[model samples]
Target: MSIWKELYDIFDKERSRWQQSSASKQAIAFELKANLGFLADALSSGLSQSAIASGLECSIFEAKLKEGAALTALNRRKVTLTFIGEFSEFAKYVGKENDALVENAYSKIKSLQKLVAAEPNKSHDLRIKSLFRFLVFLVAHLEEQPLSRTSAKKAEG
Candidate 1:
């Protein structure tokens, strides 16, 4: 079977499982987090720099516009897949640029991936708020700055 088909089948099962019961809801939540963690790793490992940069753009937009309040585990599957589709398509148009911003964004996503595993007792709402703040900074900072990030700057003497 094709990768797309396989991914759809798996997510379909998860979505079906989502509707089954309250207990299953918790399982789906963890699954979404784990998926994001795996996604970060997979995207980091294999994709071209331009593609990853595109993904980062999509990630930042999704996080900021939705304001985290709208992004819950229930909708995470859709969000994740949409990101993959968008970035891959967007990559075909953009050129190699913003390597530093791409790397920085990748690091941030890695950090976000780790947050899910870090605090088991924390409420998802709190985690969402924290992630929202983190993403908000990216949108704010990136917009104000130019994309000429060739290298990380050293402290000025």
Candidate 2:
């Protein structure tokens, strides 16, 4: 399937999982569209692979707060997939972009950390959850073959 189709599929799947009212779903969809736009813009900027990963991970945290306006658009509550499942998907994306994704993720995370530290107390739970979600997303997007499987094989020796 085309990338846009894949993204739409992901969005549809996630949207169906939500039990919220129609109004709420509409709001969520609106936010998601905005978020996707931001993601696209970021992708166009020629960010390093690490940068994309970093942005993906870091944006999760920002999605929760007003300060993370850039990322808040990406929020999709009632995410259907488990954290691990989300991570697995992200790992696939990371596999495609490797070094660039990692660098992107790292840089984005640093910026996110700064924002989180600035707020400290407000929306703490959401902030923490966002961070965890980002980590899961990163793990999912990263290449699966080389890192864990190879390491495990070596360890079994």
Best TM-score among the predictions, by candidate number: 2
Candidate 2 per-residue lDDT, tens place, 5-95, comes to 9999999887874433334424433433343445555545754433433344334333433332222122322222332342353444432
Tell me the alpha-carbon RMSD of every candidate.
Answer: 18.4, 15.5
Provide the lowest-lDDT 10-residue window in model 1. Answer: 147-156
TM per candidate comes to 0.22, 0.28
Q: Which number leads on lDDT?
A: 2
Model 1: per-residue Cα lDDT over 30-149, one tens digit each: 433443444455444764433332332234423432442222322222112222232342333133222333333446555544554565444444333333333332332323322121
Q: Model 1 off-target regions past 4 Å?
A: 1-102, 124-127, 144-157
What overall lDDT goes with each candidate model? 0.38, 0.42
Candidate 1 Cα lDDT to native: 0.38
Worst 10 residues of 2 by lDDT: 69-78
lDDT for residue 109 in candidate 1, whole number 0-100: 52
> How many clashes in candidate 1?
0
